[model samples]
Target: MQDLTLVMAQLDPLVGDIPGNAERAIETVREARIEHKADIVVLPELFLTGYPPEDLLLRASMEARLEAARQRMADKVARDVMVIVGYPGRRDGGYYNLAGVLYNGDWLGEYAKQVLPNYQVFDERRYFTPGNRPLVIEHRGARLGVLICEDLWEGRPVHQAREAGADILVTLNASPYHQNKPAERLALFAERAREVQRPLVYVNQIGGQDELVFDGGSLVVDAQGELCVRAPHWQVGLMPVGFTHADGHWVPQAGECEPLAEAEDSLYCALVTGLRDYVNKSGFKGVVLGLSGGIDSALSLAIAVDALGPDRVQAVMMPYHYTADISQEDAAEQARMLGVNYEVMPIVSMVEACNETLAESFAGTPQDTTEENLQSRCRGVLLMAISNKKGLMVLTTGNKSEMAVGYATLYGDMVGGYNALKDVYKTWVYRLAKWRNTQDPVIPERVISRPPSAELAANQQDSDSLPHYDTLDAILERYIEDDMSAEAIIAAGFSEEEVYRVVRLVDRSEYKRRQAPVGVRVTSRGFGRDRRYPIVNGWQPGE
Candidate 1:
């Protein structure tokens, strides 16, 4: 039998852009044929409409658009190079996630996705009907088995495909990025390859869609469970793998094995890719954010600069009476180092105006958090005004730890179009800042060394109202990400008072988080679509 070459097309597709995605796939097929001599080229899952098309799958024109796109690909794709692409299609009078094969201007058999993931960031069951059978096609001296994203995660799909007389398996994925997800995927695919005793080729999409970022770390594992090819994360390209039928088994040839990045580096890249795609895809001219010289804003500014470059980012420092001189200095210094447009807009007058306006309403009430919140509101107003006037989106700088405990002000500091650090915890924020500085000494050392504060009032520190971030983030991970109850968290060696207090804050802050702008999701349990909770609930903090 002759040898065969397969190219994994790890490309980004804009959601709802059917024609554009089809054109991209055609071009990728042509490139794979001419550049890599690929006999078959595989695109990622939902390449026609992009992954998680959500309610777009329910549109009246969905089927018509998909058929038109399929015809377009058939006309433009290379005739000799076989193409395996994923799209949402109608079969047996039901909408299903499908992988269709096209070769030599003719339609080959298609495989409907069997396993529909309905957890965390996925809602596939809401739109697609699951397929019950497996599909295996004979092509280029090898029998090929096909699967979709979630199919490979389950045991039955892989086993069924192998049992259907397949020598090679290919799976298209739009799998998203979370912490340590790449490593986990590698381990899982290796085990699957060993179980099926067939070479496995995994193709994944790369881009940011809404809050989800798909890191394209595509992989290929040999029949013996050894990795042969690993496409670099956060990249878009055609990765090739060669195979030959030997001893009744298709043996994959070793190819490029790009090393996985460390946790900090990978997290940093995910943030940059997510922010860049979000801004560019949304057609924003640029981004404007308040630079408070705190760790959150410092890290956020650095990420913005890295994502959109200095010319596309603007930093505004709005200082009040309580604002420290060092805060202003650090903000200005970092902006200067990053070569971004920096401006200082004092909100003292704005705060004084608001205080005068509210004086009559607060005649008998003593001054409290209400007065402190005015400063943040004034800053938010200035930032929003600048964003509107300059045609730039405002990027909020609050981190996950703050958002989890209601430490942020609603419609005040939280006013923005996006938040880069929303899913990132406070502890990770510091680590990202430190890691970024290693790439370049832009963030001031004092910014990393000093204690965190809102600077909204005299001697204001985050610790004044909440526990230390180290303890707070730990409890929050258990309560929010791990779903540990108050009692469980306390049993995990945390103080009972701190556990209950943190849990209460998280539960109470759901309304605020619901109103906050969408942001990048780097964790498994980001506040947006990943976790759903009732705004008005009777559930208490205890188990």
Candidate 2:
């Protein structure tokens, strides 16, 4: 029977843990062969050293470590099942991202990734020398062509593989998650599969790597562009895919297809996964955040509790003189409902002391955002102190909308190791809060309904400093995400004045965003790695 059973091992690999990841891959492949009768096992791209190892790839010991891993795998791995594993290889006076096949305790062949993606969160070109040729290997009457993540996305690699007489294609990916990315990926994969006219197996890594969360929606597609099997998203598992060769073509057998999560659900899961992996992988004791009784903080608090659970999360309400009674009440209520350690550390005295100490320096100046920033900075100091004392990571609660408009106080509200809502817009913050409530009513309703405020001054709403969130988010999506000009935004029906104002704010705030804490990226254009801009650019849109 010309039937091949491929086991897609969608896994989470910690960066720099070469021996551990090798052991895990070996054991998993062994189990697949013995238990599931898998003919071959496939792991995601750069699984050994982990994807985008960054500067770790430049270390002197990396090649030696990889050589050791290769020797160990060759020694311990059984000969029953063929395994395709990805790792970084140093050859020909350069380093290449490679996928090699190991079978019968022998390294059969290897393929270096051709297209090195350098945009957005990816910087593969900086570290890897792109391979010029396609690699096709034969195993048990099957011609399997190997392609790494970016290789499959570009047309040449797949067409070249087909020309190299490949019967089936196997791709390894460390593709990161952004909102609606899975759907977009599927559409692209289907197009590629149809274009190449070959059955393909796509395996992706699952879990978070700092800001990038890889949702494991590994799948199989037939030559006709039909999706045959889909592994669960944001999950780590080995999904089996069977393919049979008929007359002259390979076709994937019909199998399980997991339904995609809804928009809010997927984004929430990405946040939870990103936060969970960032804390757990970094070896943090837990997480602590100042939970203001507002939508952003409330959503962040809920995500923290969900990511690390109640015992591992601590919510502190740092109230000032201007902080409303309702804000405190809602904050405490949400913390109690979530069953986390809650505290109220009023910053009135801290602010007063700072003012008194700086009175002489600021004697001639009238009170402005400096005083407001002082309040935020006090809260930041307390949060950092608690984090240091307890050895827990501080979780900042600023959203993308605030980060885009220079609304968040740098070294103040932006003081944290991670921000769960960093890529989420303020408008989506409310939607996510409501969605979280559907799962469990941990967030107070009052918090979601209340108009957002920094509570730095009397009756100071977010609208006092910026446009309404709905308007601000819309303009930001167009200007920042879509790269629309101010004139284009005006043409799209937004007021010219508001468009110019929002555009200017987003442009000027690049410096602060450059220093802000890394957060989960749920949008296509997150502040950190996704959107990069110079701090001193003189170009103005519609000028």
Candidate 3:
């Protein structure tokens, strides 16, 4: 029998903030050492440099800076308890998402990831060269095996670790949140534990990176494929797992944890956590958004205020000539109730000036979507101007529903630094708006009750340009996210014409979405790496 104490620190780390994340990880291990007197504190994947660094890993300076931080963290280790932390590793003419064991300024062992997921929101294949070995370390009179985020998912690492006579298996992850993902992870943990017949400890990072939110639902499983310790979903905390040998089988010690949320709430928390960390971690003083008095903007405002305090959020209403008075009132009222700074910038004059410049070429053309798009473009320019002048990032409020149908104007409503609801559907936009107002009156009922519109043209309800959400979302879910063919979607109670039209729109709009800012992905298939289509393909005309 081997005696060992392990601590799983479920932390939310910001992307690209090496020093800040390193400092917090070091502090967490120190505090946990004092509180639990643990032998080892395991941090989540990429804690030192934040998870899903995306393209940030391409820069050589980032690796140098992070190495400096890791060295600093090693110098501060003045206790018997060691730390197994994750970060990027640069060696052998390539980068690897690596993890290591630290004790008193010494690194005992290291492991690079064997599996680099390239599907869905992952782009690891675009970055690192996959590692090809097993890692097991001797510590505390017992043998310990380690794996990075995607390494544990591969069968080779687990089998090799077991072959190497590992007593306990530990893994670090930066897994993203999807609806019902926690449940699926738990099942995988159980199945994997049975295969290895060792106590498995999994620690995941929590926070939002671009359009992906990592839900920090870390957990521990026993040899019998049973969950002994589970961290609460979306919240950051630490859990202690003690392993005991019972009849040559690994048993786990229990502890308190936060409860995991379900479905919509879980998805919402991921967005909030992602937004909170991205804004706070990016070193921005605050956030600014253009509230259109519509559901998408309203929901985005709610998320921003919830993530970053209301004091840090600024809402501006740039109303155009066609913008109704009710729209202005709704946006203003919501901003006031949320206790955020509100500004009403009348864009009628600004838009008129721009239209005057283009009047000659558009003389014979009847008023159409292009003119309506001008209004949106004008508002986007003003918002961007504010973003630059104040050094504040503009949060775009476009939803997946509009992004799919090309209802949003490029360089207009879509011209912000971040898009909070980019992965959320218009139907969910309404649901989230109602759910948020239930928390308080930050959003007006008028925004929810009225017809969905752009307000760029007279009575320009979204319905006039596309199908109703009740119908459109169903078609999209079946045709897009669910990966159904056009004929298959028609079989799912949607009209053939509706299915064909929606699929056509999605195919044609890939170019626009390609340029759109990354958004939090709550669905299985967002308009991101998850669903890649050819923008120049000519197969859409029913060849």
Task: List TM-score per model, in order.
Answer: 0.99, 0.98, 0.92
Clashes of each: 0, 0, 3
Q: Which residue pairs show collisions in model 3?
A: 208-274, 211-519, 232-258
lDDT for each residue of candidate 1 in 1-543, tens digit (9 for 90 to 100): 999999999999999999999999999998999999999999999999998799999999999999999998888899888899999998889889999999988778889999999999999999999999998988887889999989989868999999999899999999999999999999999999999888899999998999999999998999888999999999999899999787888898999999999999999999999999999999999899999989999999999999999999999999888889999999999999999999999988899999999999999999998999888888889989998899999999999999999999998999999999999999999999999889889899999999999998889899999999999999999988899889988988999988888899999999999999899999989999999999998998886
Residue range 92-203, candidate 2, lDDT tens digits: 8878999989988889888989999988888888899999898898887899999999988887899999999999999999999998899999998999999989988899
Ranking by lDDT: 1, 2, 3
Better of 1 and 2 by TM-score: 1
Q: Which stretches of candidate 1 lie over 4 Å from their true place?
A: none
Candidate 1: lDDT of 81?
87
lDDT of 3 by residue, 1-543 (tens): 566788899887777779888889888988888887888899988788787777888886987898789888888865788789998888788788888889878888788888898877788889888887778887766678888767666667887888888878889998888877888888887888899888788898876777778887888888777778888877787788787766755567766645666466776787788778777767787789998888888889999998998988999999877788998889988988889999988888878888899899889988877877888888888888888888788899899888998877899989987788888888888887777766677789999999988887777788887999989998888767877788877776788887888889888888999999877788888888788888898775322
Where is the poorest 10-residue window by lDDT in model 2? 523-532
Task: Tell me the deviation in Å of residue 511 in model 1.
Answer: 0.3
lDDT of 1: 0.93
Put the candidates in TM-score order, highest first: 1, 2, 3
